[model samples]
Target chain A: MAEIAWREALNQALAEEMERDANVFLMGEEVARYDGAYKVSQGLLAKFGSARVVDTPISELGFAGLGVGAALVGLRPVIEMMTWNFAVLAMDQIVHNAAKVRQMSGGQLRCPIVFRGPNGAGGRLAAQHSQSLEANYAHFPGLKVVAPSTPADAKGLLKASIRDDNPIVFLEAELLYGVKGEVPPGELLLPLGQASLKREGSDCTLITWSRMYYHAEEAARQLEAEGIHVDLLDLRTLKPLDEAAILTSVRKTNRAVIVEEGWSFCGVGAQLVDLIQSQAFDDLDAPVQRVTGLDVNRSYAAVLEHAAEVNPARIVAAVKQVLYREEG
Target chain B: MAPAYPKDLVLRFFRSMYLIRRFEERAAQAYGQGKINGFCHLYIGQEAVAVGVNEAVQPRDYLITAYRDHGYALARGADVGMVMAELFGRGTGYSKGKGGSMHIYDIEHNVLGGYGIVGGQIPLAAGTAFAARYRNDDRITVCYFGDAAANQGSFHETLNMAAKWSLPVIFLCENNRYGMGTAMTRVSAVAKVARRAVAYDMRAESVDGHDVLKVYETVKDCAAWCRSGKGPVLLEADTYRYRGHSMSDAATYRSKEEVEAERKSDPIPRLRAWAVSAQLATEAEFDALEAEVKATVDEAVKFADASPEPPVEELWTDHLVEPGERDVPPRERVRGVKVDWPRYPSGQELRVKWDLEPRIPVQDGEPHLKKPA
Candidate 1:
């Protein structure tokens, strides 16, 4: 295993996939010559050359639809949105064309394409650019949504997503781009929808993914030092959720807390709470608790921004609430 | 150049045009009987555009169109029985009755799909061309849309990107006067859709869509241009629809006299007149052709009627390609773009040799220089 940043892990997966399949190509705004907006696609243009690593104009709908068209004709196109926020402009193509193409064609065609980009809040970037858009896309049936937490998982799940024969919304976080972890030197293919139990205990269950996973990791460390052991489960894929893993952890711990960096109203965490309450109601010791980003437009100030999204403190508090730990 | 086109090809054009004409007529009748429910847009007057382009396009090439796709599907050689069955929402339909009239697609015919969204296929068409460029495959794509769709942001976005990449595709607009109830002049800043090509650094061509020979020859020449490593081309076929936009449209927007006047230049009769004048066939042969088309249309109706409703299990199926079939490099005929434009009496220069006259008054004060006189 070698220590690598999240961006480098994602870059390796893209470069390897392109090398494996001649049909796979990458295109997006500044993806080629600009080395990607976040530098995740750095050095790809030089390695793959121009034809395979293309730079598209800032026409999200056009290039997104273009990716769908290329996929329809047997080419595997990985379209990079500068950020998941801009993907809203291409929602018509995603919802109407990408998600519906396979079923609409009566299975005559395969839309083997992936729309990958940075998602969720970062720095002082307000409102438009700081949204977690997984739930919006995951609502559609035809699309498979994946949001990996660690560097190794990002690399492995990305490879699996590229090789899969369906449209996938691969969400990556800007905050995790520079985060470093040990990634396997050889090939790593993590199957989609398989949740990883980062930590196991008997007191409570902490379920999270993507940016929120980092916060949950810290919360688990804080709780472990104070002798409050909890099960930390990272859901790698969102749409085809790991229900068994979630149910098993909730049954064993008898308490559950969901931490997510999204608004609470009809959010992924809300959905998880519903699933746990309905499926594992008899096994629970107390009602499930949630730690979600405040439903606001997101503030530009550092203090307000930190308070708006999730933090380790919030996750720890939610865990205590679920476990009925009333005092310090 | 030769004196005239082959008699077989010309007659086949008439057969295709006449077949589409009758197919839509029966589709309209089926709609009245409630056999075909939902938004059914008939291709009554734009037969020359689809027949002309479909005849000119090769098997390796592709065709995608808007909701008004019954005729183009026929022109691209999709099974009439299947297309009719799709309209009737039967099990035997091309899309397993999952996709209705607005969304018929077939891989065998190289027909991408009949999209329901206005101007939605414009960007998608460019993407298909992008695939060809990526694979170094020479298959050029032809995308069809209406005048109303030209006003969409995607039309601008797609054209600019396609031209920037020099993608091999043709964006053909059928200017059928009204977009739903709104006229093109009322909505678009520039009613001449072909003129929009100039902003994208691409060439444009406007042809008399009532003339099948003109449309067929022009598309062939345009395909040749795309194959020679050029950017996308925007071709405008000035035509009209005799029917309302869809089954629900009352068509109270246009005057009855305007429709009656446009009917005088109906593509079916006009092509028959031109083909007969050029001595491609006799009147008796055309009459026989008409009788044959009527029988074919009747058979398609019977086939659609007899087809069973899709099974309950069908709803759960076709959501994704089989897992085993995923990620395999595409099965493609790597043969690069082969130009099918034959060296014969065809295209604009060939027009002088034939003594055919226009049936409708050709419009003047054109927006583009390539506008047919």
Candidate 2:
């Protein structure tokens, strides 16, 4: 095991996978000579050479579609979007080609490609740059969506994603790149669709993933100080959500609070709420509370931007409301 | 210069073009008879482009095109029976009835697909070429799109990337003059589609699409240029589609005189006249070849008509590779055992277990780091 940043863990995973499989290559805008927009792919070009780590022109739809075509053949391509925000231009390839090829071709083709990059808000980037689009991607059936909060999970989940024989939309949090954690040495492939329990409690359950998991953890600490302990669940993968872990936590606490960095309406939290109410309805003592980003375009001002988003304070308040300590 | 193709090869080109013309006519008839359903775009007048290009490239080379693709598929050697079965929405189709006229894919023949979206295949062609280069292979990818597709954002983006990476791809624009009903003059600032290639510093040319030999020679040279690592080239074939955009189109945008003028240059009769004039084959030989192609089309139609529709059980399949493992079927109630909390060791504990010093100690109440203000 070794301590590394989340970005380093992702880089390590790419280097290791590229080294393992000759067919596995990386392509995207600035992934090679530029060493990745956020430097998640730093040193890969030097380590793997240009053929394996390719730099492409600023053509999201083009390169993304190209990656799908390559995947249709026998190549395992890791396509890096500068950010998930820029990936909007390539939604047709992602939604129509990569996602539907296997089914449309009746198992004749399998697009084993991974489209990864930093996702969700990063400071006051604002509007186009700060959108959290995990739900929109997870809404599609053929895609495997995974967002890891820690460096270990980032390395493990990415390795698994690269190996999985399906199109995966791996959403990495920009804000969590510098966050440090211990990653296991050698090949450590974490299973997708399994939720991790960050903390143990019975008063209330906090469900979140990716960057929001940190906020939910902090909220758990605050609730513990107030003599009301809560369970913190990190939903590592969104599409094949760890529903058993969620129901387990909600059933034990009889109260739940969901946190997300995306907009309130039709967000991942909304789907969680539906799952909880439908599955754990008999065990609930109070209505599930959701803390999500305000439904508006992200602001340019730092203060307004912070106010419009989900944070530890919001998670704490939502947990308190679910526990009946604060009014809804 | 005249193409130096052999007598047999020239006859084959004529036969290929006629096959496409007759296949498309039958397809349109099938649509009218309610045998084939959904958006069917006939390649009536543009048979030479598909046949000429396919003949120029080797079998190992890749080909992709837009929705008006029965000609491209037939030209690329996709089985006529399977292609017709796909149009009939039968289980024996190339895509097993899931993809109709718009999405015919044949992996074995290296025909990537007949994409529905205009210009959608451009980027995919670039990527396929990138794969060939990555694998150190010598195969080139040929992409075909209509004139209207040249104005799409993907066309510009793909051309830039293909040139930048020096990928082995040939971008062929079938300039059918109209994007559905909209005239090319109204949509494009530049008159010629090949002129757009200069923006990417790539070599480009325009050719007479109705002339099979011209298209064959141009595509042959361009495909060779790409395969020899000269980078991507754009070739705009000035072709025309005699039929409407889709079966639903009334085609009131153009006058009858314009249609008549285009018909004067119909590729099939032109090829037959050339073959006879050049002494490649006599009128009797041309008639015999036409009869042979007609019989082939008839056999394909019979095969497709006899093929069964995909079973209802097939509807739930193919949407995913491992459906059972991924899809959690809906249940009446919440199932599965409750997972215990603290499922794994904490990050701090892991650091100690792995004998590594903590980079950033885990602490409570510390504000998360935000990007520089």
Using DockQ as the measure, the top candidate is: 1
Just chain B of model 1: what TM-score? 0.87
Position B165, candidate 1: lDDT: 75
DockQ comparisons of all candidates to the true complex:
0.39, 0.24
Ten residues in a row with the worst lDDT in model 2 chain B?
A: B350-359
lDDT of 2 by residue, B140-236 (tens): 9999999999999999989887776777898999999999999999978985888888787777878899999988998998888788776788888
Per-residue lDDT tens digits for candidate 1, residues B59-141, read: 88878888898888898877788889889998778777789889888676788898988988888899888777665667899
How well is each residue in A174-276 modelled by candidate 2, as lDDT tens digits? Answer: 8999999998787889998899998999999989999999988887887788898888899999978999999999999999998889998999899999999
Interface RMSD of each: 12.3, 11.3
Candidate 2, residue A316: how far the Cα is off, in Å: 2.3
